[model samples]
Target: MHRVVVTGLGIKSPAGNSPAEAFATVLAGKSAAAHLPALLEAGVPVTFGCQVPDFDPDVYFPKHRRRHLDRPTQLGIAAATDALADAGTPDAGRPAGPGTAGSGTAGSGTAGSGTVRCGTYVGTGGANIGLTADFGALPHDKLPVATVPMIMPNTTAARISIRHGLQGPCLTFSCACASGSIAIGEAAMAIRYGRIDRALAGGVDSMLNPFAIASFARISALSRRNDAPQEASRPFDRDRDGFVMAEGAAFLVLEREDLALMRGARIYGEVTGFATGADASHIVQPLEDGSVAARTMLAALADARLRPEDIGHVNAHATATTYNDRAEARAISACFPAGSPPVTATKGVTGHLLGAGGAVEAVFALLCADAGLVPPTANFTGGPDADAIDVVHAAPREIERLPVVSNSFGFGGHDATLVLSPR
Candidate 1:
């Protein structure tokens, strides 16, 4: 395997559309959650959420293109475009063979030497299909028009490729909440294996519909903090209920270390290690043993050739749900015998973005590595059930030099952990 590094990043989160704003909000320990918009209705148990307050897709996409996309696809395209631009990825097209240097191939007859061969891997979930069914019936023509053009999981990546001139492989992964992280991990591998010179990896999801809320609420999966939206997602906190539904997208530009160096890219960090596993324990609940989770983390560390103590901080996949937080904490404690490193859950500020959660949080982890600071966890008060780990609160802490681990566990018992080292 070749060395992989993250050279560019783009995010459209609840806190802001840019990395600076998102990082500032994380450092301030502020909450982006708010009462659900009137369009969402009040019957939903979890009416409050961390939504992208004022994202105007028109700013990124033209009016003609914007009208055809849903919220999720729009966000994905926005982030992907920004990442490609940041990476200086030329719109030159794909390569023709295995060793061509053009478009990521080293083979002969590559797409074009001037252009970087690239692929896209996006993680998402079932979009607002019901909305499409409803609004799609507007009868503009005999055939029902799709209210949401990209309502399926794969469309998110497809639309991104269409928006940008990425002519390589376009793949999408839907492993529930872990979708985003897996997509990024796969993208990194694509570059590491010389499949493409550059890859765009991330997630986008907008599941704020009635059906989504009802389904989660029925399963007791959503936070019922209707009255107090900001205080809802309390990861590792005793009073934590369930995850708040949210929507957003985040993307990263991954490439081989030498290639990035040659391009003079400002590397945020290196994707040192990645591992994934399945619990096979339950459909939606994590296993008590946390065997798979621990294995995933350990495997990632092994790949990075770093000890548990080498990790200075952990970006927890704390959905604020009781079961999730406890399970993740236990896994961390088992992996790191030196009493879990200082932990922070950015989901406390950005409500669980479902498929997009892992992608958005991964960006935060990289930002932390680049800035040498760990953002505080918000909406948390002292509690007994909370993990017995140092939790940064209210203010950012300087963690100058060390590696970090970002974990993401999703439904279907999927678990993924990525180890990152400062560049």
Candidate 2:
């Protein structure tokens, strides 16, 4: 089996568009949450979220082709394109929009001398649900004819596959919040087992629409601090309410370690381990005992052939909800030794990207390892169980050459973990 390494990353996230920019924002403990005009105009109960700033679809896609794609697809395509380019696979002779048939090397089965086999795997929580809601609000006769193509969750993967001429496997995972992590894990596994030479994998979700926010609000899953949007998502804080809903996309290019080295690719880090499990308990709430989450972490560590003490930093799945923070705290305590690795939760700044959360956090985890610094958990204050683990806040914490674990626990009890190590 081959070893997999991350060679490239791209993001259109609430934190930032580029990995360096996002890492800087996270290190500074900045919150992207803010009042959104669309939410306010729609009269959503919660009118704030971490929306991606300065995102222009026209920059990635042509005006004529952008009309047929949904917001998530647009974000996904942009991220995937950037990721491929970062991996030294430029889209030569490719069209300016998605859904176009591949031409020349872009459509050829082989790229970079026919030695590399590439594929695409992406995840989304809802398949263009925001667009679906828009269609529902419009008259039946006025519905766009391109609805099917625009709304499919697999459209993002398909676009990436076509755009880069990846012919190995094009798949999509829809495991709610764990979707992105699972997709990335599957891609790494494919490379490890020689199914593909490399893969573009990540997650995307553009659900900042009124219907989506209102639905989450109805379920009591959103923070209510509308007046203080910047502090609304206070993960691991005593005053925490619920998660803030955000929309964004993140992608990474994974290649076999030897092949990346052979091509002299700029390796970001190695994906050492990945594991996923379910609580088998509730659809919306995790098991309070955190046993399932603990098992997930243990399994990931085992997969990496490493002990708990080897982990020097943990990127938590803390969403700022009451039950989630408590349960995850217990899980973290159960997984690692006492007062060992520093823990940080990024959702306090980026808000919850649902399916995209895992991918974004994974990127942050890689950046932490690469930069040898653990970003602060924004808005964190002393909470009831915050002492269960060492939560990094106030400022970035520096460490060296230690493995990092990024965890993602989604609704419906889905839990995913990824273990990363410096290259």
Count clashing residue pairs per candidate.
Answer: 13, 0
Using all chains and alpha carbons, the TM-scores for the candidates as numbered come to 0.92, 0.94
What lDDT tens digits, residue by residue, belong to model 1 across residues 1-423?
779898778898897888888888888887788876642564765667788878887788788776567777788888887777666654424343343333332222233455466778898865545456556666766543554354555777887777666777899898988989999888887777777767789988877767667778999998887778888888888888898888889998888787677657788888888899999989999977577899999999998899998997999998988788878877888898778788889988888988888888888998897788998888877565455667777788888668889999999999999888887
lDDT of candidate 2 over 1-423, digit per residue (tens): 889999889999998888888889999998999999999998989999999888888778889988888789889989888887887767523332333222222223333344466778898898689888888788889888887777776888887777677666789999999999999999999888877777889999989889999999999999999999999998889999999999899999998887678668899999999999999999999999899999999999998999998897999999999999999999998997555489999998899999998999999999899889999999998887778789999999999868899999998999999998887
Error of 1 at 395 (Å): 2.2
Residue 316, candidate 1: Cα error in Å is: 0.4
TM-score, candidate number 1: 0.92
Error of 2 at 89 (Å): 1.2
- Highest TM-score model number: 2
> Clash number for model 1?
13
